[model samples]
Target: MKNLVALLLLSLLYLHGTTSLAEDINSDAETLPAFCTSYKCPRYQLIKKYEKFEHRIYNATNWVTTSLKLDFLGIGLAKSFKRLLDYINGKNSEGLVMKMTVPVRIKVPRSDILSTNATMSFFVPPAVDTLPTPLNPDIYVEQLPEISVYVRSFGGYALNSDYEKQAKILVEELEALELSYNSSYGTAAGYNDPLTFFNRHNEVWYMAL
Candidate 1:
């Protein structure tokens, strides 16, 4: 009888553990911020009111790379786009393909972004362009109207291991504020650098906000 009782307790414990894990995953998924909820996000505000840029779907596939200086983001993105094009053309089969929106929103603080000191997550974007049959030199950087996003700020840079910790903090904040969010929001990039930044660094977390 004692053995049976112990066995039953163990079963219950295992079930509880599985349930807890599932809950954590669900909670993380649901913590996604609203679209362009930032004061500094001009693109977000512009789209919110004017809808000047019609929403168009695009594709993207991102891989992890270290951005130790933050300055490399814009250039990195350009390279990534080049890679993405290569993949589409069957040049690189190792890369992944994904779908996202164009004119994607970016987030910084209400004050100067350099002073924001927050972890950022940006959307990996893809867009179609009208390059003449010969391909024009001026239509290189595709124009995308920006959208809105929700944001939660954090301090310090970190490695991949720190995602759960930061995500949990954002999750708690979202829940505390009773915000409505999507379950699809998940971690993409883990590191960012600022020294090479031509645009910004505090622009780190660009999830579905």
Candidate 2:
């Protein structure tokens, strides 16, 4: 009978230890910031939420950007991405190896004119106070002002054509709701690496007129 009682106590202790470990792991995961998980962009509060879209108001922030004058959208994006990566890899005046933050942003032409010039930008991590000077003349840093944007989000891998299509759809939705917007230019915000398997988040943003 004493042996049986000791065995029960041992089993109870083992069970309790297992449960505590599992809870600790879960708590740690929950505490990790969104930026570390799923390549979430920098922290920003949603100023206004709508049925079809939301208004994201971002504070003034700095960006590292590269401009390419390529007629092919896919080719241009690929080239620009490589250039931006170089900057993060210590190709700068300060030789600072900057931490990459998401949504890699692209400024697309407003119309379907197939222009040769487009701009791609990467957000500077919040921990950065001073902008690093780019070694390449074409790659420069800019401080953008506090801005409000209307955003429509979607999933899946996005190409240049996809951005154009999504931009059109977002404009139509906004028009139906009688919301005024600046149709001159649209920006594409991508929040995932190209190799991410599923639930890739992308957004089409327009400055609210």
Clashes (N, CA, C under 3 Å) per candidate: 23, 0
In candidate 2 the C-alpha lDDT for residue 70 amounts to 41
- CA shift of 31, model 2, Å: 8.5
TM-score of each: 0.31, 0.77
The candidate that wins on lDDT is 2
Deviation from truth (RMSD, Å), model 1: 20.6
- Look at candidate 2 and tell me the lDDT of residue 179: 84
lDDT tens digits, residue span 1-209, model 2: 00000011111122122211111111212232343353324555688888768888877778898884445324555667768877876788887775555667777566544544457788885556677789999799978888878998877766556766767778888899888887776787766654555766778888877
Residues 1-209, model 1: lDDT tens digits: 00000011111122122211111111112212233221111222212211111111222332212111112123323433333233322222223333221212222222332322212222332221221121222112223344233333333443223434544554555556555444343322211222222321121122333
Minimal lDDT window, size 10, model 1: 1-10
Error of 2 at 168 (Å): 1.3
lDDT of 1: 0.26
